[model samples]
Target: MIEIHAKTSAANTGSASDRLHTLGLALPDLRGNPYYVHHRTVDSSIYISGQLPYQDGRLLGQGIVGRDVELETARELARHAALNALAAAVQAVGELDRVRIVQMLVFVASTPDFGEQSNVANAASDLLIEVLGENGRHARTAIGVAGLPLNSPVEIQMVCTAV
Candidate 1:
């Protein structure tokens, strides 16, 4: 079995927003999409759709990882996608600190021989814990895909529970 090297947030505390500020980051104020809603809430649970690595409405990186893109680039793209997921979560619940992450699904477009999918996914996991502290720790899955929408390197979908 592969060892889990990602940081755990079990002992973390404090406001998620404050942690975000401390990290020199802010959630992007995203507008609602015309085709589909970014997230939906059923009771206390929020389901966020797959989000690409878009910053200011532009895809961050394209092409399959381990081919045209490097591992570090894919990792950063995952981080950005995770940020988009957090944005959708805030849009659904109206507050960042009011929710706790429950699960995350990370998709990486990579080559057949690329076995570092988990390593690329760690960037997203690390970002969540950094921003949400213990609330951000979650169950997660990393998937290797033949391709992704827009040929982007990474996409992230998430679930959160309002606390």
Candidate 2:
């Protein structure tokens, strides 16, 4: 059982959606959110909005990455934010396997001295590939910010190709 970094990756078969389930994970319910729509489709492209690390309606890692929050915690938050972005992709495309990730942008709210933004973003990158395989691989940018909405520590956005 080669862990996917954070308590997953025991099996390596099936579609990305199936692999998601095999890893004991489920996409969040983005049914009727009043904040903002998760994604929009233009032609064959899905433009996903920035997603924060919210699990079961509770925000996680609400602090600076290098100050109050540790590196591993921030990385896990990035992974969860990416998962949320994946959910947005599915919502727009109707199926996870039907689309391919094109690009990703990760935001980390951290201290000015922190320099591991890419390392934190790697958690998202690693999980995407672990679940979606080649289709999940994508061009990415990781940036450190002084602050984010709701004081969350990490956020992620994705662009996917659909239909």
Candidate 3:
């Protein structure tokens, strides 16, 4: 249950709706208030929950990063996670332009020997830069984990500002 930061008045409504249509994106069916999603107010920001490497509604791969999942595969997983985050952003704000991705937190499920969280997280960060241009640049955190929900390879969460 995400709250609209922008007020109900027409003055607060901007090109967000139009941008959504132009981008051909829509909100997904949310079960409840996402741990990673939030909106303070118009011109405030949108927070998206960390997303896993899920495709076709299921996690693509799992296990230690270097052992079971290859680096390239982990990178791809992060990319998908980033895309999921974009979807969440659009849904939370009703538009993408009213967004300034402030930061990204990436978590990688890996074994003790795997220490490439930055590299893996880059996949998600790079995708955001490509999709949002300069607006995607922001502070980020990449962490290695013992495991993730459903044993996914990568997970990414984002914070975005909107008006």
Candidate 4:
């Protein structure tokens, strides 16, 4: 795992793995055509839109939160969400090292009584910290929604700092 210092700098002197270990996370695969671009902004922020679970032109899994999907499934879906976010980051910055995650908002589709949103959100957080080190740590919010696009169990969106 890479360790990253919180010092705001563009050069990635820290190991990506160190950052992952710091957050107890792993790098997720960049799959699907999921990504985002920064709007015209003078600040160093990149707005990554919501990412859903998808691959090979198909949604990975979809259903009610406590129905066909379990908590672990939600976690995995969260990883995919981060993977897509990374793709967006790389597309914007040309490299992961030039990017730092600033914030994440996760949406989970669940029943009114099913409440394990934070557990699933951590999967994305861990992956981000692993891939971007200290830059990955950011403010986050996880909420349960009645539904997501294509009935997906989870959707994750992010904001990032880019050089």
lDDT of 2 by residue, 37-73 (tens): 8998888888999999988888976888899899999
- Please provide, for model 3 over 1-163, each residue's C-alpha lDDT reduced to its tens digit, 9 standing for 90 to 100: 0121122122133354443344454433433455534333344767677777665666778777988999999998898787777777767777666556889999998888888999998777766654455566679999999888877878888888764
TM-score comparison, 2 vs 4, better candidate: 2
User: For every model shown, what is its TM-score relative to the native structure?
Assistant: 0.90, 0.90, 0.74, 0.76
- Please list all clashing residue pairs in model 4, or write none if there are none: 1-17, 1-18, 2-15, 2-16, 2-17, 2-18, 2-19, 3-18, 3-19, 20-130
Model 1 per-residue lDDT at 33: 77
The candidate 1 region of ten consecutive residues with least summed lDDT is 1-10
Model 2: how large is the Cα RMSD against the reference?
3.2
Superposed on all Cα atoms, the candidates' RMSDs to the truth, in angstroms, are 2.9, 3.2, 9.2, 5.7
**What local lDDT does model 2 show for residue 34?**
92
How many pairs of residues collide in each model? 0, 0, 6, 10
Candidate 1 C-alpha lDDT tens digits along 13-113: 55788777777788876666788889989888999999999988889999999999999999999988998899999887889988789999999999999
Instruction: Please provide, for model 4 over 1-163, each residue's C-alpha lDDT reduced to its tens digit, 9 standing for 90 to 100.
Output: 2323333232245665454445454434454443434222246777876878766456888988887799998899888777777667766677767777878999999888888899889877766755665677899999999999889999988888785
The best-first sequence of candidates by lDDT reads: 1, 2, 4, 3
Q: Which stretches of candidate 3 lie over 4 Å from their true place?
A: 1-43
Task: Report the lDDT of model 4 for residue 3.
Answer: 25
Descending-TM-score candidate ranking: 1, 2, 4, 3
Q: Return the TM-score for candidate 1, rounded to 2 decimals.
A: 0.90
